[model samples]
Target: SLANAEKSQLEKELEAEKEEVETLRDNLRNRDKMMKDRIAMEESNRQEAERRMGGMSKKQMQSMEERAKSAEEEVEKSRKLVAEMRMAYTVALVQSRFLRKAMEKLNLITGVTKTENQSLSLRLSNAQKDLNKMEEETLNLKEELAKTKEKVAEAEEKVTHMKELVETMEEGIEER
Candidate 1:
């Protein structure tokens, strides 16, 4: 019974760990995609800004210059964000790797559990077969006991009949 309960608990724990690992993997995948997309988008925006920098009036050019400066600053900020995102991605990857390892461990435990369950099932089957055999033997013993009782009863009756016959014969002989 302890083994049965322990097996059940282990199964539940393994399932929860599996779900956790899947969630972590999904997060890692999403973060990787998001980082790549952000980097590509930032590069495209920078190129477009550079091309537009060519067409402008003197006054408008001054404003354009200021805008360009701001854009550069924005780009710098975006670069930093990308760096941070990359770091975050790396961290996520490391965590995902760890989670994968944990999942592997869980898989190993499940394998052990599978074997244990198989063994327990085999043992139970053997025990059931033994029990069946014992029940059959008990039935045979009961039948044999009943037959022995019948034979004993029959033998006792025959002995009584012989005794009565002997007494009757002796009386007849004495009377003569």
Candidate 2:
């Protein structure tokens, strides 16, 4: 029963861990998709700026360059965030695997312990039964011993009565 309880608890924890891993994976995928979309949008903006720069005034061109620089910085930041997310995903995956393996090992150990506990319980039950039988036999032997003592006392009384009768007969013969 203890083993079953422990196994069930472990299974629940494993399930929770699996759910966490799945959630993390979903989050990572969503972030990756968003990052890709942003990169594509930045690329399109750069192309449009290039097209405008050809016929634009000096100040307009300078403004476009600044916007382009700002876009590059945003893209770099997105890349860094994606890299961090990937790293976090990898760590979560490794940790999930480790927890699964540990849980499996714990389940195995619990099974073995349950088996051993059952075996010991059976052995203890059998030993108790044997002890009860021995005690009963001892009680029977004690009763038999008491009966034998009574019989011995009766035999001794008969032997004394016979000795007195022999003495009385001898005394009567001497008087004759």
Across residues 1-176, which tens digit of lDDT does each residue of candidate 2 receive? 77656545744654564555446445545644654564465456546644653354556545544544554454455445445545554554455455455544644565456777576456445544543443443344334334433433443343344344334444544555
Worst 10 residues of 2 by lDDT: 150-159
Q: What are the TM-scores, per candidate, against the unseen true structure?
A: 0.35, 0.47
User: How many collisions per candidate?
Assistant: 0, 0
For candidate 2, list the clashing residue pairs, or say none.
none
What tens digits encode model 1's per-residue C-alpha lDDT throughout 102-170?
A: 443434454346787577556445544544443444344334434433433443343344344334444
Off by over 4 Å in 1: 1-112
